[model samples]
Target: MRPILRIFLSLTVLLACVMPHAHASVANAPGANLEVALVTYGPGDVYWERFGHDALELRDTVSGEAVNFNYGVFDFNEKNFFLNFARGRMHYLMDAEPTGDEEGYYVQVGRSITRQRLALTPAQAAALRDFLFWNLRPENAGYNYDYYVDNCTTRVRDALDKALGGIIKAHLAAQAGGMSYRQQTDRLMSAQPWLMLLLDLGLGPYADQPMNAWSESFLPYELQANLRRIRVPDGHGGTQPLVQDEQLLSPNRLSVPPAQAPDLRRPLGAAGLAFALLLVATARRARRVHALLATLYLIAAGLAGLLLLVLWTLTSHHSAWANANLLLFSPLAFLLLRTSWRARRGLAPTRFANGVVVLQLLAALAAVLLHLLPGTVQQNQPWILFALPVWLALAWSLRQAAPPASFAGAASARG
Candidate 1:
C-alpha cells in the first residue's frame, strides 16, 4: 500500500510532450441541440490531484444523454504501469461517460466543478462530437501522457482549438505569460513542502523556461480563465466570448491552491545557519558526536544525490537533467563517510578526506557564482541558502582537526 501510494503520488507530480495521434474522419453528429461545454474540476485533497482536472462535455438536449469526454483517465492495473511511468511513458486515455455519473462523486468529495457553456456553432459542435466519439475507440483512445505539455487541461485546449480553427494557439502560443513551468509547479506544490523541496532539488534549467499562455494553460484553472477572454466569430458576423455562460455546480471544500510560490528564504536560511552553528559548537565540545552527526548528514546527502543522478542519466525525466544541485548534494560526499566514521572512533580523518571536503566546499561556492551569471535561471536560492553554510562549516571543521581522543589530552601533552 505504501509503495502504491508513493507510485501514484510521484506519478501525478512528474508532469511532460505532444505525441502524434490517429484520428478517424468526423461523422455526422446529432443536428441542432448538441450543446458543448467545458467542465473543470478544482484541485482535490489527495496529493495526486493537487493540479486539478478537466474534461470536455458534449450533450444532446434532444436525446438527454450528456457524455463527458475526459483524457485524464489512467489504469493502475495496466501491464508495466509502474515501469512505464518510471520511464516517463505514462499512458492515459479519453473516457466517455455520462456527465451525471461524475458530479455526485465530486460533490461528495467537496471539490468544485465549473461548467462553461461554449458559444460554438452547430457545425463546430458536431465536428468536436465526431472527433470525441472517434477518440472513444480503443486504438484511438489511448495517448502518451506528459505532465506540463499533454495532460488533461492541454488536451481539452487542443480539442477546443481544433473546433475553433486554431485561434487559441495563434493568439496565446507566442504571447509571453511571464511565468515559468517551475513557478507554476511551486505554486501548486506549496502546501506540500516536502514535494516542493524534492522538485526544487531535482529540476534543472529546463523547468526554468518561461511559459506562454498556451503552455501555461496546462493548469485547468488557467484554461478555464483563458476561455473567458477568447473571442469566436458568432454565426451572424461579430465576435463573441468563447464562453457563453458560466455555472459553478459545487464549491471547493479544500483551501484554494496558492497563486504564488512560497518564500523559503527565512525558514531554510535560519535552519541552515542554526545547523551550521550546532556543528561548529559540537566540533569544539564533542568531536566524536560531531563526527557521528556529520557522517549521518553525509550519508543522506549521498543518497539524495544518487537519486538525482539516476533521474538525470538513467531515466527520461528531462526536467531533472543537468542539475546544478550536484555541487551541493553530491554522491561524491560518500567519500567522506569512512573518514567521519574513523573520526567517531577517535581516529583522525585522512588528509585526502580533508581535501575532498575542501573540493566540495569550492564546488558549492561555484554553484552560486554560476547562478549569478546572466541567463542562468534555476531559481535555486532556497537550496543555496540551506546548503552553502553547512558546506562551509564542514570545510572549516574538517581541516586540521585533532582526533576525538586527542582533543582533551592536547593541553596535557603540550604541558
Candidate 2:
C-alpha cells in the first residue's frame, strides 16, 4: 500500500508540471476551429540535434478528432546497431506505414499531437493566428522537412516573413548578416514609433514573458515588459468583460533552441567563480605568503574579470556589473601589500595607512571608469583595466617607504 501510494503521488506531481507546458503549447496553435497537427523533422546533424523533438498535434474543432502531424524524420540504416536498437524501442505512430522513401531519399514520418477543450485566451488565440499565418506562407513548405540540419534560420525566417505577408521589417535576423540579434531587435523597436508607443502603454509586459525550451524564441525581456493589457471599453462609457494585451504593438518572434550538452563544459563564468574562490583561499593563509598570494589573486581576478567583460559584450552587447567590480578590491589589495612591506621592514602599517587609503580610493575610481566605458572603446584593448590594480600596488608601496611614526616623531624631537 505504501509503495503504491508513493507511485501515485509521484505521477500526480509529474502531471502537474507537464500540464502548463501542454497548455502553453496549444495557446498559439495553427488553426482556430480545425484540429491541426504540425510535425517537424530534424536533420541528422550532431551539432543541430538539439532541435530534434518529434511531432506536435492540435484537435480538429469540427470533427472533434485527434489529428497527428507528421514531422520529417531521419532515415537511419536498419543494419546500424544504434538505429536498429532505437527502432526496436522507439514507439512511432506511423510504424505501420512503409518506412522506405518513395522519392530521392530514405524517409520516416515522425509524430506529434496537441488536444485541448477550452476557449483560448485572447493573447493565446492571437499567437496561434500568427503561427498559422506563417505556417501557411510557404504553403507549409519546410514544416515537415528536417530543417535543423539544412538551413535552420532560413526555414524559420521564410515562414515568418511569408506569414506577415508584406515585407515585415519589424524583425531582426541576427543570422541574416546584420548587427547582433539583440542590438538589431532594439533598433527595430526604436524605429517603429508605434511600437514604442505601445510599449509605453504597458502592452509590452505580455510580450516580455519568458520563453521555455519549446517556444525558445520570441521577445526579449526588456521589450516584453512594455506591452500593456487592454480592458475593453464599456458600451455606455463603462468597461466590458474582455481583457487583452496590446498585440498590435508587439513583434512576431520565433527562436530555435540551442543544443544542450549532456556533459556541460565549464563556462568562463564558472572559471571566474573558481578563480575568485582561489583568491579567498589565499586570503586565509599565513602572514608570510599573504601579500604574495593577494597580489597574485588580484592579478588573476582582474584578468578573469576582463575576459568575462569581453565575452559579455560579444554575446549580450552590454558589460557585466560584476566584471567591473574586480577593481573595487584594489584598495584592499594595496593595503595587503603595504602591510607585508611594513612587516618586512620591521615597522607597523599605522605609520603610512592613511596614505594607503588615499591611493586605494584612486584605484577604485579607475576601476569604475574602465567598467563604465563603452564596449567599442574597451573592446579595442581590454588590458587597460588591469593597469589599475598593478599601479595601485606599486604606487602605494612606494608611498609607504618611510620610517615608522613613533621613530620619526622621536627623531624630529631630538634634532
In terms of lDDT, the best-performing candidate is 1
Candidate 2 accuracy as TM-score: 0.29
lDDT of 1 by residue, 79-124 (tens): 9999998877888876655688767778888889999999888878
Top-scoring candidate (TM-score): 1
Q: Compute the lDDT of residue 180 as modeled in candidate 2.
A: 27
State residue 171's C-alpha deviation in candidate 1, in Å: 1.7
The TM-score of predicted model 1 comes to 0.89
For all candidates in order, the CA lDDT equals 0.78, 0.33
Number of colliding residue pairs in model 1? 3
Each candidate structure's TM-score, on Cα atoms with residue i matched to residue i, is: 0.89, 0.29
lDDT (0-100) at residue 169 of candidate 2? Answer: 24
Error of 1 at 266 (Å): 2.5
Off by over 4 Å in 2: 1-60, 63-228, 232-289, 312-316, 319-363, 366-415
